[model samples]
Target: MAVYTKRDFSVNLKSHGGILILALIAVFHLWIQVTGLQYTTAAKTGWIIGMTPVFMALLGLAVFKESLTLIKTSGILVAFFGLILLISHGDLSSIDLISNKGDFLILGSSFTWAVYSIVNKKISLNYPPMMTILFLFLMMGIIISPFTINDASIQSVIHLTFKGWIAILFLGILCSGAAYVMWAQALKEMESTKVGAFLYFEPFVTVIAARIVLNERITLLMILAGIIITLGVVLVNVNLKKIVLYKKSKKDM
Candidate 1:
């Protein structure tokens, strides 16, 4: 990204304090997410994550002055309810099981992610997505290095199994790097509110991955909740122009 920026001084990248702040935010977000998994099931975490779009919408409205419509607002509610139902397995009492604190940690990660998305979206308006995300990755790497160094050694890297190397490369390059770049670009191209609706797909994807990789059972209730979650996201993404036209058509009667 710096290569394409055409800046006379490479040091200019350091001038973007927002990227530095974004890196620090990423650290806490990553830490809680990884550490919290020890205490809670991934299924519960993904369900909690389904609320991310609502947080994004709220932050967009409050910080960025993004507007909310009746249609989008209702869509957010429906999707969130569907998400809760999915997470709780249709029993609202299941929420009380979150008292274990891991769920709260997951909740914290969600808020951090919302802040990260909104901030990244705001910064992308000024800096190119590649530059911002690359810088963010570099800074986060520096911040995370010390904490991880004790767990990793030069010998471990040198002697890593081919499969282990593949997994590391996939996570570092594709999942963390490329995925974030695309997400930042999407936020740049669309409203944060709309960009966030895509997060509703995470749990479904996670479920599918679990079923295939871990041989987890996929139940009828899961199918029902997945459909409802998908419908809610579709509702949120529906164009306001079409909604107005539909309403107007009804009013003509």
Candidate 2:
């Protein structure tokens, strides 16, 4: 990104501090997510990870003093309900986080992601979006090198198949790199709650991908839940005033 932009990689001390903080949060968020997945089922993990929007809303309210309007609250509740329905497959009783140690870890990860989003919104405008992300990636890499550079890890990477290497590249370059840069840019222009609400689509997308890639069956219930999730996301992001004005203008015309 830096090379492509041709902009010098220089920042003030304050910007450097922001990048460091974001990097630390990213490291913790990634670590917790990976660790949590080991202790819980994918369904449970998805459901918990879906709570990120709620955490983002609450944290925005508490920390950033961002307004929590009625529409936003309703959308969050609606989306959260859809998430529960999707994950539980209509059996709410099966969704249990109390018994799983990993659930807490995943929950922590969700909260940390909220923190990252909120903090990034405040700090990201200080630099070019890609530059900020690049600096953050570098900082996180430095922080994580000690833990990941050992002989066992090196040998594991060496032993990975072509498919494994491809997966790693996809995750590193597209998922973490490109996706985060876009996310930061979104934060620059949108409210944290609105941006976070889009995360509700993660599991919905996962289900669709699984259907296509893994040839998994998609039930009617899943379709309904996906529609509900989409509606909720739209509800959270739609501007009621603009809609009302548009309607009035059309009537006048």
Candidate 3:
């Protein structure tokens, strides 16, 4: 995490392979709006698909002898249950075909994110974590340039009001550019499982941002879902060994 503040360009060399993977993630994020528009809202399907990483990790444990402690297993199950609860009300069956398309986009996004996480770990081995992330964001921005056109979706850019320009600036500079850098840096020093834990914070941030910007309602269900999702995130990232040790100490006392 200190890599975020470290100014060691010589330490962090960018790889073409990693750049390509990060670019794919940026493109996926750019297109994710299509999923929201089609689905009419972000729903459980995305969360359901997103939770596959836990299962994949489990399978790796079973097949490749990865460690599988009780706490970790419990965390995964809790997160899965929370995700199910998060989107329990929606029925994806009504629009099966388009629903699949939306699901595909979100799943693709998750895969890219996972790939980025893996690549960050590799790149950070030799380079400064911050530099690795900066380059990744630059590559991602370049890759997504075609999609961020000043056309229909970018009408605000064309007939720019002050607020529109501000929104654009916030999204481009602060949210997309800066946040990507932070994420990349985080991925560098942390295990993918640890950094990927931040994803549960995503829905909360989106909902809060939406409420503030779009003037959307802060529903009772949304609040409950956010809390549950947060709990899931906590479970996923909790140090199982530490928890066990602490409990053991308490029992000894």
Best by TM-score: 2
**Model 1 whole-model lDDT (C-alpha atoms):** 0.78
Q: Which prediction has more favorable TM-score, 2 or 3?
A: 2
Candidate 3, residues 1-253, lDDT tens digits: the string is: 3355666555323465766675675567557645544654454333443453464345445544657667667777776556545554333334354535555555555555565556555666666555666666667767767767757857745688898788778998787667876776775666566666667656656666666766666657645654655565566556768779999999999
TM-score list, all predictions: 0.79, 0.82, 0.68
Better of 1 and 3 by TM-score: 1
* Local accuracy by lDDT, each model: 0.78, 0.80, 0.59
Q: For candidate 1, which ten residues in a row score worst on lDDT? A: 6-15
For residue 170, model 1's alpha carbon misses the true position, in angstroms, by 0.3
Per residue, candidate 1 scores C-alpha lDDT tens digits across 178-224 of 89889989989998877887886898788778777767677787667
Runs off by more than 4 Å, candidate 3: 1-14, 33-38, 42-66, 88-104, 145-156, 217-228, 247-253
Q: What is the lDDT of residue 132 in candidate 2?
A: 88
Model 2 lDDT vs. the true structure?
A: 0.80
Predicted structure 1: clash tally: 0
